[model samples]
Target: MLRGFTPPYTPDGRSSLVPAPPWHYAGTVLSMACPTEPAAAARFLPQGFGRATGRIIAHVCEWQATTDGWELLDPVNAQYREFILLVEAERDGAAVNFCPMIWVDQDISLIRGWLQGWPKKLGQVWMTRSYGLDHPAAAPLRAGTRMGASLAVKDRRLAEAAVTLDGGEGQSLGFLAGPTYGLVGAPSIIGEPTAGALRLVLPGITGRVAGPMASGTAELRFFDAPRDELAALRPTGPAVAAIGNVAITVTGATDMGVVAG
Candidate 1:
């Protein structure tokens, strides 16, 4: 019998790419909310889901995660960055945010996200870090402080953003605080007539605002990459941005229902 939870399972379950969760994470996020062409955004959602609102979100964050232990001694394996693009969607009149694309820097994080239906891929994600200091380099929680982040994959840049903090917290970006759904399953590989799929809602998401949270003016851009479809969801109007620190945890997925195979 396989001893590990995932592939490359070792007898001791020590070689699995990702460990079992109830994962915990502390992170700083740069979130951008902008209007997108509803029709274009609708194309990314799975069958039975529809565009509920006109806003889309692009978020970049740097995370330190722990599963079984603090992992502070193994910092390299515990830290990673992520970039996500999500659109507002609905099914059976219940609103949910659906992620169309997401990128992560670590293989472990990537695999972990896929297990929760994030459609995460390997990419280079970078962001500005803040510190509680008066140095010119330290971006403190003050009006006019600028921060930036970018995402790239296969050597091609997909999205970039910069924000200048103004003021405010909590309700600065309320739209970002919503339930998210993902379609998880495999397609028929051997030409079978039908396969199975599930509409999974990421579960056990309990977290709170951690540090400085501020509203900001933002500039976001999307580039046309040969493979990345980010250009399709580019913002069509002014964007609202914010910077926040949050500590979050996820247990896995709860069965929302089944969708077309």
Candidate 2:
């Protein structure tokens, strides 16, 4: 029902959709290797606590491009541009793990590009270099939460509808979850909101993160397995909506649009 999407998905527990994303499927990943500075990101968006850091995040997305299944080149281009800007933010993790997942909505080619293009690290896990899908650290998922989905958007309006799970309610004009998605589908290991309200960051991933206190989610629907449209909403229990998927703060684009009327 989303304006341009059906549903989303995540990777199987088996790691079948691999060699590209998260490199490996790490469910309920449970190992804490804190970053060098928990607040290093503060410098990028330095301001009072209220100031929103305009740093963009680069992520790989894959899937069809249009409603009639045509091709939405403009939107796809917009999405890709935003991703590149995110890479410019410069986030280096003393240890950034690869927890690959599959969502149903995005395109696979684009997702691969996001991973291949972004900055990555290879460190000694237990005693081996964790690079090219061979990170040597293996911590049993100490504690993780996940959900499965199998539903679809019958109503165009509901497909892209985003409802606040809690705090972000009422403030939004309508139940529209995101500009393009309805926030449904695959449960993510990481929960950074994207794909409209349906896309988001996973709490389990956040809880185990030991980095500069910065935040992001896997955008699971973008990587969910059996990549195709017509996916369903496999439900995860209760959680936060992806409040900041496409953070738009246009301070300079105004000049591009002149008085045409």
**Regions of model 1 farther than 4 Å from truth:** 90-95, 170-176, 187-198, 207-209
TM-score of 1: 0.91
Candidate 2 per-residue lDDT, tens place, 75-184, comes to 54222111111201222322122112122232433343223322221111111111223223531111121211121222121111112222222111111111110112
Among all candidates shown, the one with the greatest lDDT:
1
Per-candidate TM-scores read 0.91, 0.20
lDDT of each: 0.80, 0.21
Q: What is the lDDT of candidate 1?
A: 0.80
User: 101-157 in candidate 1: lDDT tens per residue?
Assistant: 899999999888878878899999999998889889999867888988999999999
